[model samples]
Target: MILAPYYFNEKTNLSEQPYRNQKRRLEGRSIRDLPLYSQELLDRIRLPAERDLNDDPCWLRTYYDPSSEDSWGQIQDYIDTKIGGPVTVYNDSSLYNFGSNWEKIFLRAPQLLDNTCLFEEYEEYVEEALEEGIESESGDAQHAGENGYDPVEDENPWICFYSEYLFRLAAGHIYIVDEKTLASEGPDAGTVLVMWYDECGRAIRYYREEAMHAAEIANLAPCYLKDYACWDNAEIGESYEWGAPLGPPYGENRREASE
Candidate 1:
């Protein structure tokens, strides 16, 4: 019942235009929390690869217009149609993989993915992008987050996103890192990382703890956590072993396991 994922809202899509904005979606939003989904609920989704994602409004654009909110709502409706109830989703990446310019590439579909992907790249790109530096058309990424820029549209409107992050199973305890916004009123808001695990139990890693975008989730259970955290100490050198560092690009890893 690990509930980690990159849920998207339809309105989160880039403005329907030729030019791309700087606000790449899903830039940074990873955290650590206990298993919210019940065993029965987890069982409902039999697919080892199927982790659920929902509307993840970015911290910058906290307030969504009615239209945008409604678009996000539609994604929820679709989820309800399938699972029936406020279903919980286990995300594929680590706590660090949340933030990035790549989100814009993955928006508007069942899942998020690597920014640069081809046939089976999404399946592999998510993990691969983390290892190297991207030559962003818009070089100012720090501004990209603050300036509201998004990844340029992909070749296929239907084929957005690199791919859903793959999952590796680990076991341990859970940690939580919840963010609090001070807004402009208080001191500049900063993030807080919390570790949730049995005092007696051994500690673990939060999935996707490498992206540098997400903060740390100390003491979380490694069991069920994704082993290929976006920004873990593990380094991706000059060469690649398999396809992509993270997942199957396009043609691979598409089908959701039967629930």
Candidate 2:
């Protein structure tokens, strides 16, 4: 269940737009990837803060270092001390003293427990990173690259995560589905269905479903995933006919098969 004992879960190079023809026109050129996004934009996405600090609002932070799980807990502590403990506030004045007043109420939102921050935990961890306009502490949540993520960490095994590096984690598993197999079987709980075509003109399933849970991937086996939603994707049903009603005789139901 313990995988990469010493990897961090923080990757920040995913929020960039690829150039139109940089690779072909400019062989030896590079440019800044992440353009500035306004803090106001982030505020629109943050959760509203508590009653006293309603002006600032709260934002959840994620860890992306991909090397340390302890950092998440430590950051939580750091945030608490910076804003206010769950029930206490050290600085009455406001982050405005630091010119980021909007973040004062958000420094450590008092109501994080109201909803889950990310898909993994059912609790929210508040912070002020959103006002800074930089990706939050947990990790970048926007884009994914093919070969840059790993989900297991022996050192930080408590914090289970997914990787989009060389392999992707579907819901949490190494999603591997071929066309023939996709046609044969439908989707699973966390798995997603993808559509790719072969010479025969049949819509094939190329990817497997994501892992059932983060805990499902606590092992050493490698798994890669492409982000997708089942019952979705253009090619699955539109371009290709992957939606034929399967014949009867379904596999033994894992359920009680209600009356």
Candidate 3:
């Protein structure tokens, strides 16, 4: 769908550390108190699992900003030209279902088709994995007993509700490109590049420091898709129980049953 341009205004502040502000907004809330969205939607928009991007070789964290009023106008123009054409923009509130992580434009292209084109359409498969992490100091202090050990206090409690955010095309025609790599090579390496594209995909007319005026890089690959197989061979067994047969159906040994 074409997002209403009215929603794109000066008030919109794009930040790389989106989670920091969102966590602050929901400082004391529990998972039960969080807003609701389909698990499918969360799977599409949520950030990559720690196992995916945490150790990936291509992973780089950077930010980009439009330098001047003229630059902002150019970016806006680019988005405007793509709408109301054969191209479709897959932008719905569904993309921003994860609390305030997404700053969606309120009034844009609503005429476009509202379908699963935003990302690859996949059948629903719910798999639950338990995540463990070290406890924060505050958590340790909160439940710490005078005794030497506190089972609850010994480890920090955290819940990984969903897997990492995989980059999906909005209606198989649009993409939000992270131009940090290009910006790093340009004049302002510290700034991040957050550019939205149309059916032309990855083609953005923006100022690259190496160039005098705005330039366009078309047909950029979608690197946001992670390869899950990287850690699949690590032999991390399916269960916490020791030597309990290697795969799923952890309860009884089939061989023992046959005997």
Which lDDT values do the candidates have, in the order given? 0.25, 0.24, 0.25
Per-residue lDDT of model 1, residues 1-259, tens digit only: 1111111112123222111122134445332233556555655543322333332211121222333344334333433353322333322233222332222212222132211112333323333432222222124345333323344632221111211122111111221211222122233122211121111111212222211123222222222123323323222221111243222232222222112
TM-score of 1: 0.17
Q: Please provide, for model 3 over 1-259, each residue's C-alpha lDDT reduced to its tens digit, 9 standing for 90 to 100.
A: 1111111111122331233345458678654454566544544544333112111111112213443334434343543452322222222233422222212321122111122233322211111121111122223443234322345553411111111111221212122223432243555432223332222122111122211111122212334322222111112212211242222121222223334
Please name the candidate that would achieve the greatest TM-score relative to the true structure.
3
Model 2 TM-score on a 0 to 1 scale = 0.16
Task: State the local distance difference test value for candidate 3.
Answer: 0.25
* CA shift of 185, model 3, Å: 18
* Whole-model lDDT, model 2: 0.24
Off by over 4 Å in 3: 1-67, 73-106, 110-115, 118-218, 221-259
Model 2 misplacement above 4 A: 1-22, 32-187, 194-237, 240-259
TM-score of each: 0.17, 0.16, 0.21
lDDT at position 233, candidate 2: 22
Ranking by lDDT: 3, 1, 2
RMSD of each: 20.6, 23.3, 20.5
**Model 1, which residues run further than 4 Å from truth?**
1-67, 84-86, 89-259
Superposed by TM-score, candidate 3 places the C-alpha of residue 96 at a distance from the truth, in angstroms, of 18
Model 1: lDDT of residue 7: 10
Q: Tell me the lDDT of model 3 at 179.
A: 42
